[model samples]
Target chain A: MTTAATTHHSAVLEHRDRFRPRQAAGKGHVSVRNVDIVFDTHHGPHTAVQGAQLEIQPGEFVCLLGPSGCGKSTLMNVVAGFVKPRHGELLVDGQPVAGPGPDRGMVFQQHSLFPWKTVKDNVAFGPLMAGVGPREAESVSRTFLSLVGLSGYADAYPSTLSGGMQQRVGIARALANYPSVLLMDEPFGALDAQTRTMMQENLLEIWSEFRNTVLFVTHDIDEAIFLSDRIVVMSASPGRIIADIRVKLERPRQAELLTSPAFMALKRECLALIREQTLHAFEQQNRKH
Target chain B: MSVKPGPFQASSAVVPSSTGERGVIQADGAATETVVGTDAVGAAVEASHARLPANWRRYLVRIAALVVAVMIWHLAAVNDLNLYLRFENVPNPVVVGTEFIAQLSSQTFYLHILHSMERIAIAYGLAVVIGIALGVMMGRSRFAEDIILPYIEILRPIPAVAWIPLAILMMPTEQASIVFITFLGALFPIVLNTVHGVEQTPKVLVRAARSLGASNAAILRHVVLPGALPSIVAGLAIGMGVAWFSLLAGEIISGQYGIGYFTWSAYTLVEYPKIIIGMLVIGGLGSLCTLLVRKGCAPLLRWQKEAGRS
Candidate 1:
């Protein structure tokens, strides 16, 4: 196991030097200012996110941690420019986000892959859409597929792959465009616990090499602590940010760190915050009923 | 315990060595043998041994059923069986077979078959183009759907046969009239299915495409078109069948040289054997056209079959 890890580490380093010259600094800064999102349901206008504010530095890894219906995904979608915020605005790299563009890549939970395309073609889609020539697009796809350890299955269709493999392909497809920011909405949420752990590690390794800003959304406390540099916890019932907890754990984290006392402490803090918010949400629902 | 590296080692290695070892152990336990056991080898041999005879038996049963049906038809016609329904005027299978052979040697039979095929080709091609265009417009824009969909709904349920008299009066020639009827028959299914396919395209895919920097036209081209293909292909197949149904109606009423005209003229001339032969030829041609549609679209849908396998 140690030898394999060392070999993979060296390979990642070697590829980092060759294919991914470190991204220029100050490229992927994300600022969400007083954002509010609302949906008009049959009953009335429902507020999804309320006065949310966040700032992620270039090359930072941040996770939006919350329970279901807390609007964490909605907030991420706002950043991805898929949803229009009813009130405030979002800016990426100092530019206002008018709509979804190639500058920000997104990974959904599962089944977001173009099932009609081959794994290679799915990865190549972004570059091709950017008007890159077919040959260059093909090479770019090959590079990213190898980065995700999926070079062998490039010819296979998305549906033929396991969930973990599909998510890996989704990551490759997103990164192939060389987006300034990568937004992942529960990318590993559908995988088994074991697969999810491995995916998290792989994602961190890729992020370290690319050093692109990533805004990850998840409900798992351990996952947020394990992957992100900062964990932004949100509350349900008019979803809003409640806590912006910075993780002080050291870099190049391993699976073994998951058992470390420092990790557990962060987990404890997040758990308490989430429990309080969940109870508050429950009480609000009860009062409405 | 020793761990054997699987063929998928490069990809599975991403799972971390600990889980990979667990996977090996699970595989060994499932085989209920030593780590290097011949259990998988034995299963392969047994499965191959079992499959051939089962497939052979299935084919034999199908052929037997078809042969029995033909034999019953032959017997009934020969005996002049009439119990509330008459087989007395019906031609025997042997006589029909002889007449079919005779028709196959004649140039007029070929001409009739060609006329029917040509009408279907022109009509179905027009339907595919117009239906998809209208469907995409309706699907992508609410204003287009509201304007166009009402007229489609009102016109769709009327059968192709009902259009024959009006089509003949409106068209300049018999061929044009027959083609118009066939086009009407095919148009609705293609339009309806294309609309359903476009509307059914997953919203997530559209979002994914947009985030990947695709423009509106690019999204429609890459995401919407491919996503709606299976449904469109289904519509094409249905439209082909309906085109044949309506083509025959139009051809029988007004066509100078077509399979439907040949069949009806045979009936009027009391050429019973030729009529049976004409019916068989029409059935064969229809099946052939449908088979062509499916075969032509198979390559586009190969991913669907691969996905279904797992």
Candidate 2:
């Protein structure tokens, strides 16, 4: 059974490599150039994000870290092509983002999976939509489901699965399309602490294997630090890139790294910057009131 | 884990452990089950074991209530009880019972039932198709809504009874008029509810579909349709009820063979007992049709129940 499983795994790996040849140097390059997003509200035109300039290399994991209403998510959505920036452009692999496509996979904060579909079907949806044959889509779903440790729940509906499990399926679903860039809008924000930690670990494991460019958005400083190679901190509101801090911590990180000296130092640096911005934002709000 | 010999115990063992892991992942599944397990399971076990007796008791209670009602009716009719209302001309329970039994074996009685059923089936089926199509279009596109909504809003409030004269004039035959009234009765509720369902489909799901490389047409077919289904099913059930209501109204005025016509004709001939029988048959058939709608839609909505429970 072990030998058979190993061979099957290897064959799937070979098939995947052939299907999407990984550019060893540059493939999933994301560039956000002076991107500004504004929402027309009842009051007036509100700036959600401003002058958001950043570049993510192929296979790099970057987190847009900010407080609530900081428009970190909006910036990420621009890359996902769900939101059109008022100014500047988003480019993925040298092509301008016109609209959402299979090349850029996204995981929302919660309840994004098609509830009517079984877990296997949900994971297979991208492949099916991309015009993959039914049998091949089913096989791809199986492979991704197993990758997320949800092989037993292939037939179960998304509603039947736990939140963590649903998010795992979400990840699997996103990855099944072999997207060049994975955009996550605080996917683990809804999970409990323990589950969130486990999910982070699981995501890292998957990232190590696939090496897709990931642009994750989150409010949690620790989560951003733990998950990404670099953390792009944003101002509280009318969000702009305030700081770009590289996580020098070694990869294959464990839960214990949360308390390490280097980790704490980085966290302190992030905390000070975030505190100043949050205070400034509060004072601005007070003046408006 | 300790080995359990009994099937129940073994099953319980598996459920708790597997669901415990699931709980950690989400906390809604295992936590509730484990906390309430002993009491809930015991109650369930007792209910299952004594289901036969319990069912019998329920039937007996229903029978008793109905018997009491019938006894009152019998007493009132026999006594010729009159205050503000008159029972002097009313047939007693025994007379109606006898008439019902007689009608049960009659070929004409079956024909009346078959006619009503056939009309309802045709009208309701048409309502389901046209209502859903129009509803989806209206919900998805502002242009469609702008063009179609005025007609829907104006027609929706007008009761089916009011449409009888216009329908009779509009349709060529009595059967066509009656079916048209029934179709009109069913259409509005279905179309309105379907519109609501389509509009209520989550924005995130659409975005997810888009991100997954689904085209606009694919999103509609796969995401919007399924998302709107639960509400559509609800609309269908309500529409089935309204269809029966209008069918009876139409049949009383225009149908030659339906139960409504049978009841009205009985009133004209002073066959009071048969009138009661016809009324009862109509009630029974309406309930049955609604039950069929719910049962037919249950498989499509299985996920909703599971999600609600969790």
Candidate 3:
């Protein structure tokens, strides 16, 4: 495919694949009941997510897991206060979902590091915006950079660093805000296999220590099985939750768990559900044809 | 299709520096090549010969070119190459050089230089302030762009000297009119370029700043301006050139003292060498201004150097 055509296809597929709302988020609490996401594309109303309902407790690492084209990201946005659901109430901290605030930190798939900013400056940006003094904000940023194993890279520009290094800066930037909950949209989806594995382990290590309530979206069932305390599986087309598996694995889940029979078995089960969703999607496409 | 004897691995790589040395001496006069191995990141040395930093070498070349030009002038003047031209008007290079030196030491030339410099200083100051303000404003919002771009484009096509009549009508004095005209010349290029630079700042850069929780003002200062720095410096250099052009034009039309005024005065008296001197002085001053601005921007844009190394 031509590059422009491919990009256009990806963008269209992105909108068809994930739900993005046009309006600001509202609130009562961060709860979604029968939420539906529909977009008016050139092909008419493209239903991204339909009837997705989930309850996330405070300090829970919940993974919204599904196959490609599933609107798992749609559900994450609903909770992050970026999307206003068509037919549901979303809440955070016992209040309805308002527009994005410092209370919820978001780490994107791409690091999106400011090329002009040094690592410390990029990390300290939120605190600086919130009127924190430079010296204090800097100290906090340094601590977070150290946590991410990028302490020496504090003065480095994102452009100078590798993709993995840049993403560490992104994580540090979000964590420096000390948000109650962290929302990640496939933060390691762009990394190579080795880097992605390293990042996943780093993320789990972070979760074990801070235990920040996380709503992560990913297509990798293995990753969901590895990182999540519970996995929320959704189906595509007009998206809906096919399964919600509670992972009752013990605390301090290490990378070693990934090789265990138990983790593999869980991954197999999740893969079965995603495969079923893919089959259903094909059948649906055939029906339309 | 090969494994061990793959084309890339088997090819003998000619190192760029040696090739470049040959290229500099050859008729092509370009940097021939620079060897780049995969992931062989190296420290940045100075600019290549082709990308050589403008230095005394360039000025010396300019001087050599000037000497050649002078010799030609002397030849043509003495030999009467232009058979159709009148004899009384043409002067030899030596006569011009002697006259130029005498003028340089005299108060008459210095007064003109002072006058031109004063006009440039004032107009350039105003141009920078207005251009930066307009540029930043135009850059920030699409609405401002829609309103400003059409007007800038329309006025840009109209030469700064074309506004002289209008300036004369509006302003009471000749000095005011000349300064106004000069300001018009400097202003358009500065604003146009500044606006272009600021608007062309990468959207990704702005988005990165936004995600970092930066205020709009902070984004403008830290991201937008720095991102646009190279272009802005380019614009400043171009603006100085335009300012110099305007200064000469203004003096030509209305000035008691200045290089342009002196050149025009010499032309009326048929003094060809003094006119040449005025042109050279203008060229020198313009080059100096550009060099100063370039030096100022170099440290702030160290990434440009890093980019070269990589």
- Between prediction 1 and prediction 3, the one with superior DockQ is 1
User: Candidate 2 DockQ category?
Assistant: acceptable
Specify the highest-DockQ model's number: 1
Candidate 1 second chain TM:
0.83
Candidate 1 lDDT, A1-289, residue by residue in tens: 4564454446544433443344344689999999999999999999999999999999899999988999999999899988999998799988899999887899999888887899999999987887777877887887777777778888988877877888989998998877879999999998888778888888887776568899999999899999999999898878988778888899888788899888888788878876786677668668989
Q: What lDDT score is found at residue B232 in candidate 1?
A: 74
Off by over 4 Å in 1: A1-23, A272-289, B1-54
DockQ of candidate 3 compared with the true complex: 0.11
lDDT for each residue of candidate 1 in B90-121, tens digit (9 for 90 to 100): 98889998888888899999999999999999
Predicted structure 2, TM vs. truth: 0.87
Instruction: Arrange candidates, best DockQ first.
Output: 1, 2, 3
Q: List the residue pairs that clash in candidate 2.
A: none
Superposition TM-score, candidate 1 onto the true structure: 0.87
DockQ winner between 1 and 2, please give it: 1
Candidate 2: which stretches are off by over 4 Å? A1-25, A272-289, B1-56
Calculate DockQ per candidate and list them: 0.32, 0.28, 0.11
lDDT values for all models? 0.80, 0.81, 0.68
Off by over 4 Å in 3: A1-30, A38-46, A67-87, A277-289, B1-74, B83-93, B200-208
